[model samples]
Target: MAKIWAKAPSPCIGVCKFRDEGRCLGCQMTKPEKKRFKRLKGKAERRPFFLMLRERLEARDRWNYWSRMYRRRCLKKGADCPLDKLEGAEREARAA
Candidate 1:
């Protein structure tokens, strides 16, 4: 069964750019975030990292920049939002 926070909210708006390779233009994550996503060890340990990445995204002053580019990416698909899927438990616990 899907856990309470089993999956994180996807940043994607139906714009997948990683279908060909382990790379994306929409949310430019490296091969790691692109491939081998389902095998993440734990959500508790991974949420902070994604949160950091999100903060990084929001902190950027550039309108169209690279860091801003992939900060959103960090994942290849929705229902599969890497940030949330990888770190949901940690995120939930953090708020508590």
Candidate 2:
């Protein structure tokens, strides 16, 4: 029997404009990464991608914004957010 897999949700925030640096102004994903993201399957495949995206967002100083949006998206989907494991600061910020 084939193993069932759960797909990781997209990190897009609906702001698709590309910056001059060739990254998305919203999600911070590069055009090529965004295209490849659509073709990726399963959490196993997407985990590393999201980790890299988080690093990119951190480099661009957009980690907090992305974390909040990601949490909201997880809530909306009634899914457990993997981000919670990596973003304790986001929870504390919200509590404040």
Candidate 3:
């Protein structure tokens, strides 16, 4: 049987300025991706979104900042964070 999981919350950190035509400087989500994120239903659906976002963050050299913000978001929402899945993020969070 397939295990169903809740949809992860949006990663927006309230900093909505777009650094370019499609990318947001805050959450690092592209405009289309942001829209898709809002409509996505479950963990199965969001996995790819997070993966894409992670790549964007890494590309922009903002993984550390995004990781910290995401952890805070998880704490605020009482949701299980995917920090451990983000490479080196868990350790970085622990050290801070």
State, as a TM-score between 0 and 1, how close model 3 is to the true structure: 0.75
Error of 3 at 59 (Å): 0.6
Candidate 3 lDDT by residue in tens digits, 10-42: 878778888765678888877777777788766
User: Which candidate ranks first by lDDT, i.e. highest?
Assistant: 2
Clashing pairs in 2: none
- How does residue 18 of candidate 3 score in lDDT? 84
Model 1 earns a TM-score of 0.36
In each prediction, how many residue pairs overlap at the backbone (N, C-alpha, C within less than 3 A)? Answer: 2, 0, 0
Candidate 3 total steric clashes: 0
Which stretches of candidate 1 lie above 4 Å from their native place? 1-4, 9-25, 59-96
Candidate 3 worst ten-residue window by lDDT: 1-10
What is each predicted model's overall lDDT from 0 to 1?
A: 0.44, 0.74, 0.72
lDDT per residue, candidate 2, 1-96, as tens digits?
Answer: 001124446788778899749888889988888889888776576666877889999998999998888778777877677675445645787899
Per-residue lDDT for 83 in model 2? 71
**Candidate 1, which ten residues in sequence have the lowest lDDT sum?**
1-10
TM-score against truth, every candidate? 0.36, 0.73, 0.75
